[model samples]
Target chain A: MDLVNQILNSFILFKAAFLILNLILIVFLLVVLQQVFAMSSVITDAFDSGIIRTVAIALLVISVSLFLTALVIL
Target chain B: MPDLFIAPLNKQEEPKQSDDLLMSKSSLPLTELPSNLHLFSSFVANPRGIHFQNQDSDEKVLLFIKRDLITNIVWVGISILFIFIPIIIAVASPFMGNFLNFLPGRHIFFYLLLYYLFVGTYVFVNFFTWYFNIALVTNKRIIDVDFSSLVYKNVAATKLSLVQDVSYDQVGIVRSIFDYGDILVQTAGTLDNFHFEAAPSPENAVHIIQDLIGKEARNGLS
Candidate 1:
């Protein structure tokens, strides 16, 4: 029973750590997104730049979505 | 009658296109050649619709280069390996026994999802690093745009007038096989040298720059 309790406690601790780490990552991704915008403005292409920005935005969205889902489920 | 009347108008226009027109015509050899580049190209000659800050309105972008596409194979392979981790673990689960129980239960799905998302982001960052790290050869100048680690970027450019020598190095078999190598541009005086690493068809690029230099010298523009 004690072993099971310890395992459960460790698991919760790990989960909390993961959530905090993910929050940091979310913030980092925002910076990456901003850099993409900054770079696009510095040098640009006619047709393909929109796709690059959109992909960066998509990566941010997916990361945020995963963080929120993890927060609720865990 | 219309042809005869229009012929004199054409004759009157001939003097307008004298030495300046001939110089322009001489420079048109490469410019008149069609150079169309797709979205993901590594070596783009005469790419249309590429513009940079501080660029002249009439400046022409001659080449846009990134590291060869083959360079991304390492990250792509690792991402593929990561993507299959769950399947690999599932196959090994019976042999491992109770070890699988160590995973955060009920939240395993969320963990897996998060892990995959991290892999996705890794792929994205790698792609972005490759995609944005580019060297451009324009009629007016050479520009190197460096984007690395998603947090740092540097853009450097030197006018065609400053370019003194352009050369390339293809050392190893891999570069030779891939036909991509580093291009070094020796600039005049104390200006920084420009290096384009793993540029495609480097000889072609050197030739283009040489042509531009020759033109600049001929026109006394440099």
Candidate 2:
């Protein structure tokens, strides 16, 4: 019973660490994506601005939402 | 002593195209941009509407093209499969209930949703790469912009006067029906060959380049 309890505690700790790491990674990706979008907009002014902006904003929102979902589920 | 022989050889080697004839005949006018071709969604047929990076004050964009939309069918099919596979698995879950005991119910669904979102993001990024990478033709140069991968991009340009030969090949039934083909531009000396692959109306593109080259020749002669 004591061994099972110790294993359960270890699993919980691992799960929490995994969630935090995943959240950090998602945040990093969000920053990288935003920078990429900005650079693209600057380089290709002839591209459809509306579409680029829309997609960028959508990605940002979805990523934040995913982060929050992770917080809740984890 | 060899002057008489040189004159005849020079005359035979020279093309018979006169500057006056070339100038008198207007080049083919740029046509309306075609549709149902995702690759050429924003192909600038005329010099009036578009601009490019590092464009000179006087240089004009004659044509901008991307690969044929048909080329994307395979990846698009795969994306469709990714979207449907989860639903298919869910539908079959009843039969494999025992098999999936390891996946707790609501949490498994959430995890699957997260996975789909990541895939969706990946697909979005690739779509931008496909849509933005293009081949451009300007009055003075032929330019190829390749978004080869997520982290790498390459742009190559050569002057129209340097282009030695231009040819096109339209193979396969679909390409023939749609009049889309690959335009290959061979440059003089050691420059890399420029390939405008799966370009729509390649014959017209070739004519445009030929007219530009003829104009350049005329300018040089005068």
Candidate 3:
């Protein structure tokens, strides 16, 4: 019984570590998205298409949502 | 009989300067390019500048250049190695047995994916910043656009007449072999000096600017 409990506790710790890492990754992704938006605005001459900006925003939003949902299920 | 459907082509010589074109101290059209002037190999001249949404109608781009592409080869190689690191470790683990057991379990796959995505984002941001930062020479002005990082950018411009001196430096064997060097333009008055870093064929850039200065001075436009 003690051995089983020890194994379960280690599993819990591993799950917690995964959660913490996911949170950090989320924050970094947000920063990256912000940087992209800032760069596009500051260098307006480079990105000519409104559709490209829209697509970039959409992809970022969908990825963030999906990742969070998967983490919640886990 | 000559084909009646074909219209006669005009053999009349085009005027050196069009009456409709506006003349500014800083703008020069491509048709009026200086004698014996050739842009460095890296540069592509556009009659109207690219990446500019509201560029002046009269502003003609003389030379457009970016840093030598050879400089990015190392970073590209590093990025590729990083992307394949997990696969490499996995393939090697079988030969090494439990010696590689220290590696994270399969449960870490999702986390690893996210980590890789973050790294890929960083690489992409840096590459675009390097690619977009450009040095421009136009009939009327010399421009330097620098994008140092995601958060910071700087653009400096000075009139042709204000270019007091132009010089180039090729200090190392790599630069000499690549034919890529730096062009320094010393401006008069309060304007800051424009430094074209890692410019390809720095000699031509210097000559082009020098020619512009001489022409401007001789025309009494300076």
lDDT of each: 0.79, 0.67, 0.64
Top TM-score model: 1
Q: Per-candidate TM vs. native?
A: 0.84, 0.75, 0.71
Better model by DockQ: candidate 1 vs candidate 2: 1
Off by over 4 Å in 1: A1-8, B1-34, B102-105
Q: Please, what are the lDDT tens digits per residue for candidate 1 over residues A2-54? A: 99999889888878977886887788778878888888888888877888789
Query: Quality of candidate 2's docking, in CAPRI categories?
Result: acceptable
Q: Is candidate 2 or candidate 3 better by lDDT?
A: 2
Q: Provide the lowest-lDDT 10-residue window in model 1 chain B.
A: B13-22
- Interface alpha-carbon RMSD, every candidate: 1.6, 3.8, 5.7
RMSD in Å for all candidates: 7.4, 6.7, 11.0
lDDT of 1 by residue, B1-222 (tens): 355544344444223322111222323434443367655689866677888888987777777888988888899999999999988997898898957787756667777767777887788778878888989877778899988987788899998888899999998998899988999999999999998888887877787777777766756742
Candidate 2: residue B15 Cα off by (Å): 22
TM-score of chain A of 3: 0.65
Query: Which regions of candidate 3 are displaced past 4 Å?
Result: A1-66, B1-42, B47-49, B99-106
Q: Report clash pairs, candidate 2.
A: none
Residues B171-215, candidate 2, lDDT per residue (tens digit)? Answer: 999999877899999999999999888887787778777887767
lDDT ranking, high to low: 1, 2, 3
